[model samples]
Target: MRKVVGIFFLLFSLSGVTEVKDAHSASHTSVLLQSAYESVEPGRSFNIAFTITPKEGWYTYWENPGDSGAKNIFEWTVPEGVTVSAAAYEAPKRIPYTGLMTYGYKRPSTVLFTVDIMSNYTAKSLPISLEAEWLVCEEECIPQYGSFKLNIPVEKAIPNEAAADTIASFSTHQPEISWWDSRLIINDTSSALTIEMSEEEIKDYTEAYFFPKEDGVFTYSAPQTVVGMAEGLVLNAERSNSLNKPEQVTGILFLKTAKGDHQYFYLAPTLETPTIPKLSQMEDPIEMQSFPLWQALLFAFLGGALLNLMPCVFPVLSLKAFAFVSAGSLSKADRHKEGWAYTSGILASFLAIAVVLIALRSGGDALGWGFQLQEPRFVGLMVIILTLVAMSLAGIFNIQTGFEGAGQTLTQKSGAKGAFFTGVLATLVATPCTVPLMAPAIGYALTQDSITLTITLMMLGLGLASPFLLLSYSDTLASKMPRPGPWMEKVKQGLSFPMILTALWLATVYGDQTGQLVHLFAFVTFVAFLIWLREQMSSPLKRILILGVTLAFSAWFLGVSEKAPDRALSDQPSTSNVWTEQAVSNLRAEGKPVFVYFTADWCITCKVNEKVALQRTETEDMFKRNAIVVLKSDETAGFTPDTLKVLKKYGRAGIPLYLYYPKDGSEARLLPSVITIDILKEYIEGKGV
Candidate 1:
């Protein structure tokens, strides 16, 4: 439905709509104005949150003031250099009282608004003023007001720890685009509003509900239906017939996962119908990691360290290198600061991966490393982001956002994003390492419990982070380095080309996996439009909206796309035959030498074999010359009951399985799951394994 923005934007925009609210002590509540920033810098923006704390046993109202309570109001009196965004309120808990339903806070609460400080302000300190009014209720209602002013000092606009934590606590309840392939069934004849997530992700949640911030869309009193299974979940809410059917839909989805309850803000992902691609093309790569903890740790660390010098991580490395050099000189303290920051960023990124891995393991998702590149849409999104970053690096448009800023201007102090933030993102983009090389290590970790998995992943992170951290902190490195200057600019700009190349590589991988580029190209255009829109947005509020929406879309799209199938690769024509006991026995009975192989769509090892050996023109020619029939059995979407029986009979149940039966009726030979082209050629040439 084309609805008003969620409670977040509406809450901030309500500044002038209500009568002035001033400080006052009432029967059950009090009001006060506070800022999240300790001080404000010119040209920067900061948050000023309203603390509408009530006495014990009392509650305050939501922005919509659902059903009965009056909405809180605010008026601002600020310094001439200051401007404020419309107000924003935290998500409220649903409270049921004496035959009425209300959405509000029971304990001390906060509502926030943005304040922008003009760049021209020369004042050493500024007076900020705010007045507010709210209603507090238990069985009865009480009106309250407060007037507060604070002289905030003129200093670097650093964020305050407590204020950020407070905002995050309340904001966690807001709905966000955390799911991909999500849709709002707008024109459906069914009375319920339906939402769908990928099968792999939805099964994790047991209960869900959509809360419409605006009125007239959904009946607050109507029940919600939640259907979840191995594939995904579908949530339904009754449509309000009194209101016209919304062309689009927006609301918060309250979800309960293993981590507990959360409000994931759902902005419309796309109006198009989400396609259900086939299952994964390769057997999961990470599923093979079954080493003991010590071995897993050692391998993980080695794998991580190798990533630093890998071609895929080149772009990130260049950014960090330039940032380090531009600093020119660093004292002992400076080295310590830089080392810790970069290390922290890497570890955080690794932990995030662990969380997803653990959750998917618990939920029964058969995904491995590098599988993310299989999704055309996801690869396309990465292309968009990378292209934007390249443009920014080449001076096409300046990106003030954090991702691009991590490598930002090398001259900027401590590299705004520096090594730390870049390390996190870089590690994620390091998809190449998750395959054949690291597969055994990662796979072993995946099979173990969460604790072992987490420990193993941390080792990997430490290995990847060690080089940068050590380089920054070591005094000897400074003496070995060339002095920083204009030469650095040439290197910085040159690095953009490699990033663009990486983007191209991603696009090629997308085409290989999906065999389609329509969606990929479309997403690039969408990203360009948003970036252009951001450039044209002179107003801070406009910029915030554009940024928030774009980010939400990116996050949701990537998460969903990662789970999509590889249609082109998994469903492609190949020279191998599908395996079945009857088919194999019949061929052998016909006096034909038969070659049998087993594979699954989700097996990365299977995919490599397909490309390198089975699909080879020479291999097919040899099969024909020798009158050998090639057979293949697919287990991409997991094994069916019949396939399971076949697997068990073969003395092993996993892929890639290879068996050779000679025409002379000699016993069949079983080959290794991972076979080399040379070895396969030897077998085809009558050499026994």
Candidate 2:
């Protein structure tokens, strides 16, 4: 008769009727609410337990459900002035499902909560309600929910031995605060948790696993490698690509003793500063030997020389060429002075940039080459400077230094000072273009000492200035130049078009960085007004004042522009097919050849490669023919640590990084910084690898 009545009550609860009961049963699971005390006492705290039992072969999730699954959620409805603490979960078991790992319980689990009663309570009875939800999973998942209600008399607390015993039985499953000192060391690719204990303390432990309370801390499916040391044990695991480097490593460490007993300990370990491993220590796919100092310096020089041919540098080079043309009539000694001055300017700029890069890196910033262009303010400033240079080149107005007597033209000056500033301009414009050997050289330099970095950058600057420097020294080469004529002015105006185009490109980059066009429009308008003021104002003092005010307003506008939203790529592909670590892994697992290219709006070489090779019809057809999955990692708005990790793994510090992963699970091959259509076809055809 009692069993029949319990069944009727279960059925009645399932019918959604509100009733004062201690248990609720669903199809796949059953939930029972039990309190340590039968009656509530004012101003006292008591514990309540929710025992969730899943049917055979089914399971429920813990707070962090590993790779995939939702944890149990509880919502309470109690009288005012009563407080309820958050539910505390038992240490979960590692449940392996196919290729994924999850954290949950296969059998019964108890979650405890503490309820505090107010001293001013005057009620005859205490009514408590709970809405509980959980996901039960086996081969498939089913979401289950239950509504439970209980009523207790508001009198002196009376201990319930049965309820206390039930709760005590599961107390062993709860994790105690860890006694061992633990520290977590994180790196670019992996993290290590080290627990300091005597060997005798862990002699009986056979295996260990950690379940982090935070999601995206480590790869859930990746195997945790345990290494035993004289001091203690260390568990090393792959770092998740989405890891944000939490302040503390909080988790539950589950240990299985040799006696088949499970011991759980709660850990909140201190996080040590992360250190990137030396390139020589990296595993396969990134297993290349470390770059020699000589090789790095040589590559920097060669790459810097090649940078002259990049599109972005062409405009600035043309200005230098015009200076050379005007210098043709000067004495050879004067020309030599100009050459040395230009070289000095290039060297100084390179050293200054390198110094800042080193300083920032020492301060724990993961910055790279051309990092300044990633700043919208810096990009906006470039746009303004370039626009001014373009106007000067177009002969819109000659910049008269009051010291130069107000009649001298900037181009015709061709003095050492003019050439020096021209060299500075060239270096500034050339930063975004990474020629063939520059990536590795820059990457290696960044990992080296300050002295090595400075020397390497100086070598690069020297190489960039070499061609003009040699030309200036050789009288024969200077004589080969055409004499100054009216056509020089035409050529100058034609060169202005490239400068304008470069400014437009930078403006586009600024827009992408800020996600707003209004600021850019206002800045451009200010530039136009400056041009008009220069043409209209005759007094030098008035022109200077107007230019200063306009510059101030432009700076203000840039400061107030809205920052771009963070763009995180989804695991699945969208219409644009942005790159994500998971997406690449999934594509490769499907036996498809994957092509990934890293780019940025500030990177001119990347844009040129896209226009000339990757975007070509033949390249598209080749990709389709090979069933290639193309993924793009664009770091225009800002650089992500994940993207930086991948770049550094391939021995690169900046973009135009291309990789081709074959369908046969072979090693991924790194492509060149600059790729042509034939090069893409050769790689896609498996001939280049």
Candidate 3:
């Protein structure tokens, strides 16, 4: 911690002098090379970013510069043994000039690439030489071209915080993703190339535009309708303006999120239909689904209301309870104001998560609710957060909002902010668990229009916040609270137990996600040592040293750890069969009823339903009596693309998906997300409740 604080302060000292030199040709547009690190470490991979900023009203084109602008071209002259990757193009913002609509940046944007250094190169100074050219236009196009150089002294220096901040700001130009899918509709008259994905993928934008990779394939300025479909969302693009079509269409789809977050999608749709082996997928592609908006709203509200009871949310409930109890001295109006603020914070967080979800999903990233929990890195971070929160609650730290120390009194405004922060924390912790009511609503929200999605999420937030809001505004509830004193301190300290438990749980989850008990537990021990070291230290220097080492170690570990080895299906129920379409086919050929379960270790609901339904003796007997075959797939520690493909085939984004296939050769039935023993029995009986 002491070392970390020292480095932080050192970086802060350098912030003023971190010079960035821009290479400009006549000032219409400027290009700059900025190092994201203080020094280029030997044999380490780091980023050297290119920032393209156009003067007011002028713009530079993207790689696929729409109808006519020239794409930016860059060449580098580097020392031998150095490997530089191709540029990671930032999503281009729309640049409309004259009568033509072009694609590129009108403001500042960045393109980053990784530079790998060779171990053999031990030089003190390494020169970075580069030449770049691009077409910039306001009314008329100007071909701006230039050469630039930077001499980077090789050293084992830390990351540059200022350059990092700049990189981060420019990095938003990176694309947000959703799953990638091309839905082709074949009819007698003509075939339409439809791209179907989650509506949340592009829900933020009011306009839909496509820039084809191959020229003459798509009409550059032609309008495309972004509509919500049953499968999720689709961009029904207009054909070429010249009535000409390419054999295949491929390019980038750009959308500015409701929050002004730019997202890009690299769409490459095959001219023909796709085939997934071992799966008989959904057949229809063009019949766009129009789910009624009212049903989604109702489900969303119900799901949010039930979210409070989830394990992911329970640990944070104490904080909201404490906030409510702490509000005893405040007047009714003040309490009401705090409640509104708290509610707003939750709604804001949900909205932000929605925007992020849409962006990433649109970018072809396989993401969903509880996705962070699926990541070992995220689980590790949660461990750190819970540990610090435990320490704060146990009186180890006097954390405050804009206040100096314990001697200072907190104003009502700060108190309200704390309440708001607690609400935010509650929503964050609640994300990992798909409780009974929330699964449908969360699933539904991802498919709706932005307004509907936001409204749906707001309903969810209201449900989560409603109970506390009621308490916040209630004078009667406040009257029931014991006064804040020594007991309050004791209660706060006691609250630390749950936080520690949560930290432990998160640590265990990290192990589960990685399937490396040794490494994860060792990592946890290191973190524990740091926490203990902080408590034992009176000298601030020693504390920072431990904190810095721990953090740096964590950063290094997450950066280079190999993927976790695959987990076997040995722990599955003895009666449960291994899941495979071939197995199902064989069983059905033999006239046996089959029940298929799709699950993952990261899914808490999967474990619960596994214990409550499939593992039950009565359920087993019912299955046996009906001669049923139970098949389960555990997609926990490795890349099981087949599992993911099967999941997608079932119209599911993630796990705990249950399907019942009767031997009668009837259509398969989808079991509810939260299935009861009775429901499972009815499903086996071929009559769903």
Query: Whole-model lDDT, candidate 3?
Result: 0.66
* Backbone-clash count (model 2): 0
lDDT of 1 by residue, 112-171 (tens): 788898999999886766655678887668766554556678778766665676677657
Candidate 2, run of 10 with poorest lDDT? 401-410
- Write model 3 residue lDDT over 45-118, tens digit each, in one string: 87888887888978877777865688778899888878778877777766643223567887887878788888
Worst 10 residues of 3 by lDDT: 401-410
Worst 10 residues of 1 by lDDT: 281-290
What lDDT is obtained when candidate 1 is compared to the true structure? Answer: 0.62
Evaluation by TM-score, superior candidate among 1 and 2: 2
Which residue runs does candidate 3 get wrong by more than 4 Å? Answer: 1-289, 394-414, 448-459, 535-550, 560-562, 567-576, 638-653, 686-689
C-alpha RMSD values across all candidates: 30.3, 23.0, 28.6
Question: What is the Cα-based TM-score of model 1?
Answer: 0.44
Candidate 1 ranges beyond 4 A from true positions: 1-291, 309-311, 320-336, 370-380, 401-416, 435-437, 508-516, 536-539, 548-689
Predicted candidate 2 versus true structure: per-residue lDDT over 286-315, tens digit per residue? 111124577888999998899888898998
Best by lDDT: 2
